[model samples]
Target: MSGDVVVPAHNGVRRGRPPQTPEQADEVRARIELATAAVFTEHGSRGLSVARIIERAGISRPTFYRYFGNAEQPLHSLLTLSNEGLVGGIRDALARSFEPVQLGIAIIDAYLEWARGHGPMLRPVFAELHDPASPVSGYREEAFDDIRALVRAKFTELGRPLPSPLDLDTALQTCEYVVYRVSAAAHPGSEPDPADVTEARLTMIRSVLVTLGNRADVERALTVPGIFDERV
Candidate 1:
């Protein structure tokens, strides 16, 4: 008498048939990735092992390999997920406004909000990005480039030329400094409201623009050459 094989749902107990849907696979992968991130944050990425992930995730040992090829892949996914969420804020800021000063404020607010939302995942990613020896050290360079390209497009639309000493890379680095310092002050983990964070970020942005003499630079960067080109 042949029946069917069963798969476990919770606490390592078999309760259902095999997962056959893409959604199911994605859900499983997400759970495993989250578990891996939690463990890695506690143990460090290099210290994580397949056996430990299985133990931490409460899945079978082979289940770990079935989802992620190895520990590093899931760890990377977690970091990427954290970064993606942060980037989403930037994307939102861009969508919300074209005025450089407003956009700058939006960028700062978005960064602070992301930190408040994902402090656990971000702490390690932030630490790794700053540490030259960490595997993720070079990752932020690509992120910076992406952001600069975005800013460049905005500047071109505003009929402003890129300023001297404020090339794409330098601009990104400057933006990154704003994010890091604001995030540090916000202490998302302890903050009761994001108002203080937002206020602090606005003040910081004003100071940076004044000190760098970028107020005009920002205005020029956001000037649209044609009315037809404006989306909103």
Candidate 2:
């Protein structure tokens, strides 16, 4: 039978054929994830439902179920996308730096840029992920592990020893938590003044750098043109 052949609805599956090609399947999944992000941004995860996703994506219930077993699936996809983008940004930034401090600045600058750009979608997604009861917490943990590995690699590349009291894993985790809390605070609909939020982010970056024994990097990062002045 052709891939487009419609299958009968049974066992709670939707009544439609799957996408005919891998590309089509990918497109459908992207559409659903985008719709899911939009819905989650406007209405927190608690408000997200399979019906709302179907309405937003113009897909049927079974189609959604075919692509995702539950409402969290799309959110998980969004989180995965976010994590990939972040890792990509960090890697790109690190490529442009030679010194450890420069690497630190690059990472912070890239993170702040991403946080400001995707704060809306990230806010709700992370809030849900941070919840112990969330079904997709594994995704969050995995993403963090990837980030931690990247950080450790950067430090190793610098050839600079980490502070005596700080292990690589703990320091990376601390930095990650700091970024998470800062991004959460800077999310849209929180602080009214963008300047204040921007300052708060700068402070967050500076504090994290200091915690990592990179105070000089904080100064260099803040001196970068448009790093602090731009409104998120």
Candidate 3:
């Protein structure tokens, strides 16, 4: 009977015995958040379900409501957090100037590191990349939009002829496809192998450079001694 009483939660009714202390409540809230992310990782946005989350979290419906209005809140929060982290480093790198090849390597570096760190969560998030309703779907475009604007500003500041805008956007998208492949990897022995990871990085760099009409420079950069060496 003690555990059956209805209690107020943050946004829903808590059906179980409530936390006796603020710390306990916070702890339960964190557990729910983790569970939400786990569910999101297992199922993309389209497959999200409150029932599954509650089952996964081992909490009653009311207890789940105590912290969230719905199942999507927790994962949305996670996506927001992940988006910041994944894009922040690239923003910083983009703020500074780099040679053409250097820029390619820089973006590749940022992307790979972010993927490795977020690998567990990456697969599901990227699966919905083109899903109009998915939060993750537009993130790549938004980041690319920012990059295009920034490159325009930077090039104008240098008094150089503007590269074709279409080319730039297509190039970025081309490279993004590679990242998506790595991130949304579902097959066994996909990205974990160091060789596959290395090859992906090399391809990303080369694709971007070639698309940008830097074919002459690509060979030189690609040949740079140790350019393909995996970063720790």
lDDT score, candidate 3: 0.71
Q: Higher-lDDT candidate among 2 and 3?
A: 3
Q: For residues 7-35, could you state the per-residue lDDT of candidate 2 as single tens digits?
A: 66798677675536988889989899988
Tell me the number of clashing residue pairs for each predicted model.
Answer: 2, 1, 3
> What's the true lDDT of residue 203 in model 1?
55
Clash tally for model 3: 3
In the range 1-232, model 3's lDDT, one tens digit per residue, is 4577655776886567654698888888888878887777777776778898888889899988988898788877777676676577666666664566676677667767777776566777667778888877776567666667766765576555567978887766676677677655546324466766777888877676676635656667756876545568
Q: Rank the candidates by TM-score, best first.
A: 3, 1, 2
Which residues of candidate 2, in runs, are more than 4 Å off? 1-24, 163-194, 214-232
Return whichever of 1 and 2 wins on TM-score.
1
Q: Tens-digit lDDT track for model 1 on 81-198?
A: 6667767677777778666666666666676677667655555666667777665666666665566666666667776675454544454565566556655564444543466555
Q: Top lDDT: which candidate number?
A: 3
Better candidate number, 1 or 3, judged by lDDT = 3
Question: Which portions of model 3 show Cα errors greater than 4 Å?
Answer: 1-29, 156-159, 183-191, 213-223, 226-232
* Minimal lDDT window, size 10, model 1: 221-230
**RMSD of candidate 2 to true structure, Å:** 7.8
List candidate 1 segments past 4 Å from native: 1-19, 165-171, 174-196, 211-232
